[model samples]
Target chain A: MNFLESIKVAVNCILQNKMRSILTMLGIIIGIGSVVAIVSVMQGGQQEMNKTLEKFGTNRLIIQLNWNEWDKITSRDYLTEGDIQAVREMGEDIVAVSPLINYGSTAKVGKEKEDLLIYGVSPEHILIENIEMVKGRFINDDDYKSKRAVIVIDEKLADKLFEEEEAVGKQIVITAGSQNNTVTICGIIKAQDSALGSIMEGNRSTVYMPITTVNKMFYDDYLYAMSVKVADSDKIDEVGQKIIDLLHRRHRNENKYIMQNLTQAIEQVNQFTSTFTLIIAVIAGISLFVGGIGIMNIMLVSVTERTREIGIRKSLGANRNDILIQFLIEAVIISLIGGILGMLLGISVAYMISSLAKWPPVFSIGNIILSFAITTMIGIIFGVYPAYKAAKLDPIEALRFE
Target chain B: MIKTKNLTKIYKNGSIEVKALVDVNLHIENGEFVAIMGPSGSGKSTLMNILGCLDRVTSGSYVLDGVDVSTMGDRELARIRNRKIGFVFQSFNLLPRITALHNVELPMIYSGISARKRRKKAELALEKVGLADRMHHKPNELSGGQRQRVAIARALVNNPAIILADEPTGNLDSHSGEEIMAIFQRLNKEGATIVLVTHERDIALHTRRIISFRDGSLVKDEPVTKPVDAVDMMAKLSDMKDKHNI
Candidate 1:
């Protein structure tokens, strides 16, 4: 018989016993569903993490000096003017260094006040931090040289304060404990789509000012942390080590500064996400294996149940090949239908899971096609024995079977 | 036409062997309506199985339509069964899941006939058996006579040259049995060779030839001078039943 005829016969048999066919398909449905759903959720979360990491500028290093309680003398371990000057004079791999002194302050627009992280840095800090301005301009070298009382606030935060007025030329009052001042908004910086505007999260957001103004406002001629930018990304590790050595020489404490390559740390997190996705996929694969066994069991039962039908077809001119094709086609069509249903189920469940976890849903057509191809393979692998048993049946005995 | 020379069939269960058919020689011409009558386990059914190409002969050669049966393989035998011989069974073995028309179309489907041609031929076969109006009904929905007619339609749909019917009327009442016999008679008159197996002498009396078997051997093979008319026999049998009731 031709393929179409065999398919027609197989479809007729499935229809004749609809409940059994559907029950058999349930195993495949759950198997493919769980596998694809877990993969999609992991991929979507990984993408969100990637967006967050991109907010950090390329080839940048952060040096924070908080060496636990072993170095408890704040004056000795903490950063100072000498260490700052030493880092800038280190090596050619180092492009620029910006000493940062942050003061947690509150900024008020009329009566609306919100707490914020107010950073004090040189004009080079804007380039090191990769701040993109949406309005006005970042702190220039002239602003730092003259110690201008000017600031650049996050665009989203400024928009919240002044709904109708443009924020670049506006002025806001700032307070830090007993210290108070007013600074003009020199620029409005746009935040990355999936990141918080400030490095630190709070009620307000980020604001940048000249390093001279912050040191004069709150410090006693010392500093805490600094951000260093590398001229070439490939030499970041070498440059970071040089800066650390320079800081250690100035402070006379080798273990005082903690240097972190933000880019490398982000890559490590990405690696962790991929490993996590693989581990879950293997667990899901076990379920699909069990489901394939379930399909084999049901197909064997169907072959036994339809022995007489096989005999009738044989008597009607069906050779062994024809009978084999009929049973084999029946098994494949069952799993194929189940595979399609599972694809729909998996995609929807992934979407629901991503939404609940506060991430965008990721749909992979390649993964979906792979799901289909795997199920088809499973169908053939599981179907062979049952179809062979049916094909090799003795026609006389089958016909005589009640 | 069918010719068997010293055909024997032995059923073996490990070391023990039982002979179902023993050295039987027989010849049947085309367009002949013949019946083999015997008690149960008398080798008539075994002979029918071999003649229908459903079983193998343990010894000797049987030839149907000029093809040697003993030397043919399973695939060739299956082809012969499909193209040359048709079978009708006692239980009216119509597939219960499908309509009468689809049941009739089963044989034609395996023969590689186009779908439209198969449908047309099935309709014609169903109409020939006077089941045209009931073509869409499942076997379970039809009466015993109608179901047997559907079986007969399936047997002839492939246009096989020889029809082997093993107790075709065994499951039916006299009224339905006579109707089945009438269809066989009409088909035989139209030049289709037929071989029927039955236990009832009354059923055997309607055929033109009678072959009687007992204890794995044929006792007699002879033609009837004048066959009994099935219509007349069925009416008389019903009248006899009525007389006994009174």
Candidate 2:
């Protein structure tokens, strides 16, 4: 018989027992569903992590002073101007370095006063931290060298202060413990929107001022943290090590500084998610394996149950191959249907999970195709034995079967 | 036309072998309606199985229409069965899930006939069996007589060389059995060859010839002095019932 005719027979058989067919499909559905769901969650989590990492700058490394007990007493474990200059001459690895100093300050603009974060950064901080401007310009080297009292306010702070009008070129007053410094709002950076960005920016409004101006106003030459940008992502760890080594040697201690980079963490995160996906896929695969056995069992039962019908078919001139193909196609159709249902359920489940986790969920066509292929393979692998048994049945014996 | 020479069948399981048939020689000309009658386990069913191409003879040669098929392989025998032989069973053997029309179309489906043509042939066959009005009903929805008619339609739709029936009326009431016999009689009169296996002497009397078997051996082969007209017989029985009511 032609394939279409055999498929029709198979489909008709399945339709005859709608409840049995659906029940037979449940195992495959769950197997494919869980696999797809886990893959989706892991894929979404990975993508979300990549975005967060990219938002925070994957090539940027943070260098912090890890003060020893002796150094803590004297408060002498910090990078100085001479160390920054030395690191600048290191290599292409150190593309740019931004010295950051954070402090809490009260800001007043036309009778509006609220606590805001005071930031001390160089002009290169704009590139290192992926900071985008909404309006006006960032602090230049001229402002830092001349000790100009200039600051950049984010759009949120601008909206808070001006309510509707622009805050560019406006005077912003920063008072920290009675030390007040009036600085011009030289630039307005775009406000953060993503959850990670919002958390990074925090509830406190942020205002950026030149490092020279902050150092003069705070009366301290010490730095809080330094943001180091690497030219190549692959060379981030090597470059970070070189900078740390230089600083350690220069300071005459090996444990005085700590370095953190997004590149290193990305590998760990990628490894974790891939392993997590693998583990979940394995668990789901076990269920699918059980499902395959279920198919085989049901197909055997079906062959036995329909033995007389098979005999009737054989008497009607069905070749061994015809009967085999009919049953094989029935199994394939069952699993394929289950696979389709599983994928839909899995995607919806993945979407729900990602939404609950507040992560961006992504769907891919490759995984859906993979699920289909796997389900079909499962159908064939499990279908062969039962079909063979049916084909080998003797016409007389089968016709006599009850 | 059917011919068998010393056709023997031995069914073996482990060390024990049962000789279901032994050197049974038989022949029936084209357009002949023949019946093989025996008690249960008398080798008649085995002879039918071999003649229908559902089984192979353990020894000797059997020829049908011009081809020797005694030693044919499973695949070849299946093809022969499809193209050259039709089988009717005691239980009607109609697939319960499908309509009568589809059941009738089953044989043609495996023979690679186009669906439209198959449907047409099946409808004609159903009409021949007097099941034209019940074509859309499933076996479960059909009476035993109607189901047997569907089986007969399925048998005829293939247009095979010989119709082989094993107890075709064994499960039916006398009236339904008479109806089934009447259809077979009609087909035989239309030049169809038929070979049937049955245990009923009355049923065997309806055929043109009777071949009796006992203890795995052919005991008798004789032409009927006068074959019963099944259609006339059924009509007479109904008329007798009308007379009894009066």
What TM-scores do the predictions have? 0.89, 0.92
Alpha carbon lDDT at A56, candidate 1: 61
Local distance difference test, per candidate?
A: 0.83, 0.86
Q: Best candidate per TM-score, number?
A: 2
How far in Å is the alpha carbon of A69 misplaced in model 2?
7.5
Candidate 2: which pairs clash? none
| lDDT string, candidate 2, A1-402, tens digits | 779987887888888888988888888888898888878777777776666687677689988776444445235557887778888889777788888788888898779997788888888888887678878899999998998999888888888888888788889788967777788888898775454444555667777888888888888777757888889988888888898899888878667777888767778978887788778878888988888988898889889999999999999999999999999988888889889999998989988887777676677899888898999999999999999999999999999988
Residue by residue across B1-246, what tens digits does model 1's lDDT show? 789999999999999999999999999987899999999989998899889887899998899988888788878888888898888989877778889999999888778889999999999999999999999999999999999999899999888978989899989988899999989988988988999999988888789999999989989998888887877767887899899999
User: What is the DockQ for all candidates, taken in turn?
Assistant: 0.64, 0.84
Off by over 4 Å in 2: A15-19, A67-74, A103-119, A132-134, A146-167, A170-184, A189-207, A212-221
Q: Which candidate is the best by lDDT?
A: 2
The per-candidate count of clashes, in order, stands at 0, 0
Per-residue lDDT value at A269 in model 1 = 69
lDDT of 2 at A26: 85
Model 1's DockQ? 0.64
